[model samples]
Target chain A: MTQETITTDVVIIGAGPVGLFAVFELGLLDLKCHLVDILDKPGGQCAELYPEKPIYDIPGLPVVSGQELTERLMEQAAPFNPEYHYNEMVEELRKNEDGSFHLKTDGGLTFHAKAVVIAAGGGSFQPKKPPIPGIEAYEGKSVFYSVKRMEDFRGKNILISGGGDSALDWTINLEPIANSMQLIHRRDGFRAAPDSVNKMHALVEEQKMKFHLGQITELHGDNGQLTGVSVKGNDGEIFQVECDTLLPFFGLTMKLGPIANWGINLNENLIPVDTEKFVTDAEGIYAIGDINTYPGKLKLILSGFHEAALMAQAAKRYIDPEAKVTFQYTTSSTSLQKKLGVA
Target chain B: MHIVLVDGHGAEHKLEALEGWRVMEIIRDHGYPIVAECGGACACGTCQVEVDPNWAAKLHEPREDELDMLDENYGGEWSRLSCQILMSEELDGLRVRLAPISVKEAA
Candidate 1:
C-alpha cells in the first residue's frame, strides 16, 4: 500500500499485443516503457479469453494461436527489457503542470511519465457476476468472486458455483477448512482440468462435500450476509442450499472501467483518436488497439500494430520536441538492429 | 433470411440475416446489444441468447465445448451461445431473446 512514484519515459495502460508491440516500437527509439495490465498475465484477451484459439489474419504468419502470438511479441519486445506491472489497473490519470502525465494504479503504485499510451483492448477484465437477482447485495460480505485469503473462510458454510477451473480449484482448496462445502453447476460436466475434477469428486464421494447439478436462481441473505441460495436443478426442481458464503466463478468479462472517467472523448466506449499519430483528444495521451476508434477504424490486431508504430514516433516527438526521429526499417538500419540485439 | 431479436427491454426487432453468418454477428451488425467478446471464437459466453422452445428443437444440440461455456456463464435450458448458431434457410425467421448478461448494462 506504499504510495511510491516511479518515473518512466512512457507508460502503457495495457499489456495486450498492441501494448507489448508498442514497447518494441518505443524501445527502438530509446524510450523506456512500463506496461500495466488488470490481468495477472502480460497478454490481455489473448491470454485470458482464448489462449489456445487460432488466429488467421496476423499477416506473414498464416496461422497462429493467441498464446503463441503473445509469446512471440513478448520475446520480440524482451530486448528492450520493458517493465511489466501485472494485476494492476490504471485507476487515475492526470496531466502534470509540466505537461508530463501522472498515473496511479489500483494496486497503489504511481507513475510519472512523459507520454501515456492507451492500448487497453476492451478496457479491464472483471469477474462476471451471475445474473441472480440481489446477488450484488451479498458481494464482498458473503459472496466473493475471487479468493484472496483461504483462512477467511474457515469454519463457514460455503457454496461454490460454476464448473470452471476457478470453481473446482477453489472448492478443493477450501474444502478442508469449511464446516460444509457444496458445489452447484448447470450440468455435471466440468471445463476444469481432469486432475482437479477428480479430486473434487473424491471429496464428494467421501461425504466430505456435496455436488449438485443446478444453477443458482436466487440468493437469500440479510443485510449483506448470505444465508442460503435457491438453486434450480437440471430436472426443473427448485431447492434451497444453505451456506454462509457463496463463490460464483462465472469467468471474466471486459468492461470499460475507469477509462470513461478520463477526459478523453469516448465514442460508444472507444476512445476517439486521429488516424495519423493515433493521438487522443488529450495531448501526450494516445490510444490504439480495439479500445480506439476513428473514421474508418477496424478493430484488428494488425491495425493496432500499425497504430503502435505511428504512435511511438508521435510520442517520441512529444516528449522531446527538438528530437529528430528518422524513419528506418529494422532490416536495414544498423542502429535499429543494434537496439533489437541482432547486430 | 431474417430473425426476430428480443432486446434487453423485451422489445422485438426483426433483423435480416446473412447465410453462413453467426446469429451473434447478425445481431451485432444490426446494431443490437451483444458483447461477443471473443469475436465468434465460442470461448466467451457473453453472446448468449434464449431460443424459443419451439425453435430450440429445430436447432442442433450444443456441443460439449459450448455446454462447458454455458455452464460457466449461468446458461439455462433454453440458453445458447448465439455465436455458435450459424444462420441458414432453416433458421430463417428464428426467434430468440437476448439474455440479460449478453446485453451491456446501461452505463
Candidate 2:
C-alpha cells in the first residue's frame, strides 16, 4: 500500500441522486464534497436504465423520461460545482476513530473525507443477453448486448430479441438505417408501453422490418461470420431466418457487490435500513436509492429524491454536529447555528 | 392461473397470475412498487426478489441474463428478479420475499 490520504468536509460514494444532492446541500452549508461513481456519467439509475422511459411521481410533473430526469438532476446540482471522479469502482470503505472515512477504488485511487454516503443505485445495472446455444461463437462478430456508438449499426441486417419496451423501442429506432430489422418475442403479445408498441405497429405495417413471436434457439455461422438462426415460435414450430446481426435486449438485473457481505441485514437482496432515517447498520455509513429496504419504500425517482435530500441532511449532522439544516435540504451555510440547538 | 407469493412493500402478496403475464407485472398490477426497470423486459434487475426457497423447485432456474441481473443486485443463490418468472396458475401460493430495494435502487 502506498499510503495516500485526502481530506474534505464530506466524501460521497456512488454519484447517484443522493450523492449529487449532497453536493447541493453541502454548498448551502458552505462545505465541499468529493463525489465518486463507478459509471462514466452521472444521473445514476435514471441514465443507466430506460433513459427514454417516462417516470411518474416526480412531485410536479406526472411523468418525465429517465434521460430528461437525469439532465435536470445534473443541472440542479451543478451550481454547487461538485468535484467528481468517474469510471471508478469503490472497493473498500473504512472509518477512523475520529469519525472520518477512507474510500478506495478498484482503479488504485483513494479518497479521504469526514463522512461517506453509499448512493450506488441497487448496485450497477447492465444489459443481459440470453444464453442461446452456440451464441458465444458469435461474440464481437455479430452479437451485442448494449448499443455502443449509435452510428455503428447503420445499414446492417438486425434481429432484436425482447418483449419489454427497450427491445421494442430499439426495433423502432433502428428501422430506418438497418438494411432490415426484425423483433422477436417469446410471447405473441408485448408488454411494452403503449406508445412504443404503437410505433412498432406502424413500422410493421410499413414493411420496415418484422416481428416474430418466439425465442432464438441457436446461432449459425461459418468462419465467425453470422449466417442465420433457428427459432421456436408460439405455435411450437421451428424455422430458419436469415440475418447478419443479432441483438438481444433482454434487460439486466440489479447487483450489489461486497456490501451484501458486510454483515448488514437484508430482506432478500435489498439491504435493510431505517424507514424514517435511511441509515444502514454499519454506523457512520448510509445507503439510499434502489438498494435500500424499508416499509412502503416506493421505488420511484421522486422517492429517491426525498431519501437523498433527507439523508444528506442527516449525514451533515453526523459530521458537523453543530451544522443546522432548515427545510432539511437547505445547505447554504452555518448561518443558522445559534438559532438551532442540534449541536 | 398460477399462484406466487410475492414480497412487496415489506409484506408478501400471495398473487394470482394469468397464464401469460410476467411475475413483475403481476406484482405491479396488484399495486406493489416492484419498479420493473426495462418494464420487466429483463434489461435491468430492479425487479429482483428472493425466490421462496421451497418453491425454487417448481420454478425454472434463471437463465444467464437473469442470473447476471442477480449478480448485479449482489445476487446470491436465493435472490431472483421477479420479472424472470412468468405467471402460471400452477405457481399459485408460492412464497417469496421482496428484495429490500427502493425504485431508485432498482433504477
Candidate 3:
C-alpha cells in the first residue's frame, strides 16, 4: 500500500496545551500547522492522567479541570483549522538536505514540514509495565499490554489482570470467544464502571469465567510462550492459573520513548533549548513544555504558552527569512484579531 | 523531624521533614528515585510508598481520590500515595519504603 506524504508549513509533535497554543501562535503569523500526538485524542497528559483534576495555575482561569482546559485550548485553536493526527507517534525525525524536516509516525503517516515543534510533555504516555520479573521475555508473544484484535485470542485460554475499566471490559468482551477466561486483580473491589463490574460478576456467577483475587507474581513459560502464571493471593496462598495468553492493564505512565533516539541533546531525559526561541541545537526545531529545560525554566502551562509564542516568531523567521514579523497585540492589532476570527 | 526512606535496593536513608510538605516532596528533595510525576497532585501514583505497618495507622486515612489513584497503580493495604501524606508533628519519624513502581529507572 502506498502512503501519501503530507506537506505542511509547521508540524507540532504534541497536541497538549503547549502544542495547541502553538497552533494559535503560528496561526496568527499565517502559518498552517499539523499536530501529531500519540494519544487517541488531543490533550496529552491533561486528558490522560487527570482529566477531572483542577488546575489553578493556568493564567486568567483561576480554576479549571484538565479536560476543560484542553477543550478551551482546542476551541481557541479552532480558528487556525489545525489538523490533528491522534494515536500516532512520530518514530523518525530527519532533517532533509533541502533544509525541510521529514517525519514519520508509527502508524505509517509521513510528513514534510518547514518547522517542527516538540511540545511532548514528559514524552509519550505509554502503558505502564508491571514490575513482573522475566515478563519482558514474553511481551509480544503470550503477554500483551493491549489487545489490537479480539479475534486473535479466540479459542485461547486468557488471563486478564487489573481492576480498571480495561480489565473488566475486556474480561466481558473476550469471555464469549476465549476457551477459558479468568480475571485476576489485586483486590475484590474494582475501579471500573458499575455496569461493567456487574456484567463481569454476572459472568462469574454463571460460571462463564473465573475471578481470582491476587497479583501475578511469575510467568511460567519459555521461548516467548506462556503456559501459566503464579498468583500470590490476597490470603497468602500461591497458586498457578493455566493460560495461553496474559493481558495486563496497569494504567499509563509517561516515558521519553522514541524522542531519546532522535539525536537531539538531552539533559537527563529533558531537551535543553534556548530560552529565547525554545529551539534546540537543531535548526528550525523547537522544544517546549515539561519536556524542555533552560535556565529558570518552570514547567507550568503559562510558561509553555510564553515559549510557544516566542517559538512561533522564530519559526516564522526560519520558514521565510525575508518575511517581516511585526509584533502586535491581539487586543489592538486588527490583523491578529482577524486571524483569531474576531476582527 | 526526620522520615526514614527505604530505597528499592533495601538501602535506607533518613531525611529531614518539614511541616505542611507532602512525604513525596521530602523523598524527592532528598534525591531519591521517586518520580512524583504529577508534582504532588495525588493524580499520578508514581510517588507511591509502602508505609511501615507500625506507622501506617498514624497517617491520615487515604481519601477517595488517593485510593482511586492507588487502585490504578496496583496499590495494596499498606500502599499509599506519598503525595497525600503531609508531614506533621504527630508523625515525626515516619518510615515508608518506596514502591517499586514509583522508582524512576535510570534513563
In terms of lDDT, the poorest run of 10 residues in model 3 chain B is B63-72
* Index of the highest-DockQ prediction: 1
Please give, for residues A30-149, the per-residue lDDT of candidate 1 as tens digits: 999999999999888899988998999999999999999999999999999999999999999999899999999998999999999999998899998888888888889999999989
- Model 2, residue A48: C-alpha shift (Å): 2.2
Error of 1 at A29 (Å): 0.9
Candidate 3 lDDT over residue span A17-131, tens digit each: 9999999999999999999999998888889887888999987899999899999999999999999999899999999998899999999999999999999999998888887
Model 1 alpha-carbon miss at residue A1, Å = 3.7
Q: After superposition, how far is residue A124 of candidate 1 from its true place, in Å?
A: 0.5
Per-model TM-score, in order, reads 0.98, 0.56, 0.97
**The best candidate in terms of TM-score:** 1
Which TM-score values does chain B get in all models? Answer: 0.96, 0.81, 0.97
DockQ of candidate 2 (2 decimals): 0.11
lDDT of 2 by residue, A1-343 (tens): 6646656777777777656766765565556777877677886766666566677867887888777776776776676667888877777777778877777777777778776767777675555546566777787778887776657889989988877667787888888889999988765456567789888988889988788866678888886678888988757789988888888876554467656645656675676788566778866677777777788887655676678766766776787787665563224434434222222
**Angstrom error at residue A192, model 1:** 0.3
Q: What's the CA error at residue A340 for candidate 3, in Å?
A: 1.9
lDDT of 2 at A34: 78
Worst 10 residues of 1 chain A by lDDT: A129-138
The recovered share of true contacts, given per candidate in order, is 0.74, 0.12, 0.35
Tell me the TM-score of candidate 3's A chain: 0.98
Regions of candidate 1 where Cα sits further than 4 Å from its true position = none
Considering DockQ, where higher is better, how would the candidates rank from best to worst? 1, 3, 2
